[model samples]
Target: MIGERWINLAVPLALLAVPLYALMADEPFTITLATRATILALAAVGLNIALGIGGLVSLGHAVFFGLGGYAMGILAFHAQNYSPLEIGPLTFAGTKSMPVIWLVAVIVSAMAALLIGALSLRTSGVYFIMITLAFGQMFYYFAISWSAYGGEDGLSIYVRNGFPGLNTLVPIQFFAVCFVVLCLALALNAMLRASPFGLALNAARQVPQRVETVGLNPMRLKLMAFVISGAITGLAGALFADLNRFVSPSMFSWQLSGELIILIVIGGVGRLMGPVVGACLFVALEHWLGGLTDFWHVWLGVVLLGIVLFARGGVVGLLTGKAGPHV
Candidate 1:
């Protein structure tokens, strides 16, 4: 067990080093690519809590993601305009600090998840999936119609958000920010998995009736997981917007939600670090395929279909032996 834990921890840390090395080697392409993988993996980790561990199939996670991006975009717009986002007398503006952006993203996403989860949890299986997808589409359309922040076009930041002690514009420093956030998300997931609530959540996923019989409310457990998952994913969205120095309604689309789910599925459901491994593989495939051919997505689809049908367990499951306890 100790050996397993060390390996688990070491693998991600070693993976983290790759970006730094790429930066030192002046491999700008690889550095930026790795940074993206890190951020996406963090988002996947958040989804894993609800979809993998809690057994909730949420197809609308992009709602929270887009919300986070919009939070950053809107704030930056107001800041640049030197005007308050006003509704009558009440107004607010954006901040340049990453921490502030992260906090707002978390709060907004958490609240949205609470409301969405409450409604979606009323159903199960395919119904839940459809409802969540609908909610996501609702937000996507809203963004497209709302011209306040570039609407269908998008919003761009004049500069990347700042951190207190770091020059975020530097590629290495920005990668470090993403790396640290990813580590924090992983650590939080680990802690939650080991907690009693996590145990109940896992149980609720496998045996809701038994959980209820044991006097625990499965609904509440799932809802809590859903909210936390949203918050984590939202933070990733904030980082993503900063990475590109832009935000758009496209980020909230159903396709983005599908991709997040795909990451978890390809990584190995319910496994810690599975998302990280999967994100690395996914991004690498995209980069390589993009280089090889313009229609890489066509080939990528074939590969993903093969994994879904033949692999049964994802890449991690194939490598690690599936009989071990869930992460």
Candidate 2:
């Protein structure tokens, strides 16, 4: 059997190779599909940090995801419309720059995580899940009612945000952008998982009492993990919006959050490359199977059930002949 580390390395390289092949084959749509997988993988990576490593089973991650999308949409929307964004006494101009939009997305998502986690982290078990879901639903409805930015119908950005030295309008170039960001996010996850803070967070998840006895605040650690997760997910959301050139209330839907969890679950929780593998599988299934039937979700559910009952380690775990640790 192959080592999981090798499998991990192969997964990312395979993702990269596919799009490169697509580019050479003049398959622009394939590149787009790969880019979508990359962004979803990035979002799952964020959730892995929280639910996988930190044991925070949140269901409201769509809040951060939608916020990130809206951040980019609102900024690009204003830029294209030749209007300024006004927040009370302060007046600011919108930006079409990817860097600027990403920064705003990360900061806003992190701040929202802090506030939501501060409250939600106080609860445990199913209550935490419910509260997070409630928050997600709240945002979903709010986005629907936000008529300024197209409200329930969503907002569209006519132009893809500009990235320095890259022609984002080109499919391959845009994919490169998402791929690079995904790699960076993966690197961050790797470092965070192996760091002292990660160990502490894991400890808090595994045994809060022991962590507390050691003069550490478990809640604080969890909160930080949640914030980091949100920031990464938010960045993915921004990229996703750019990919589609649109943002909608559906971005905040509970279904999106559930899918995020499914990606992690199917990929293998707590593993560094779990989300990547999961996202690839999901996109592949969605693309290929979806063409055959509208009830692809039923197949997806069957797959999920099998993974839950027969192979708790997920795809990665199965390949390595080991079931990974559950959250």
Number of the predicted model whose TM-score against the real structure is largest: 2
**Best lDDT goes to which candidate?**
2
Candidate 1 lDDT over 135-251, as tens digits, reads 999999999999978989999899998999999998888988889899889889989999999999999998999999999999999999999999999999999999999999999
lDDT for model 2 comes to: 0.95
After superposition on all C-alphas, the RMSD of every candidate to the true structure, in Å, is: 2.0, 0.7
User: What TM-score do all the candidates reach, one by one?
Assistant: 0.95, 0.99
lDDT of 2 by residue, 193-278 (tens): 89999999999999999999999999999999999999999999999999999999999999999999998899999888889999
Q: Where does candidate 1 have its weakest 10-residue lDDT segment? A: 318-327
Q: Backbone clashes in each candidate structure, one number apiece? A: 0, 0
Look at candidate 2 and tell me the lDDT of residue 125: 93
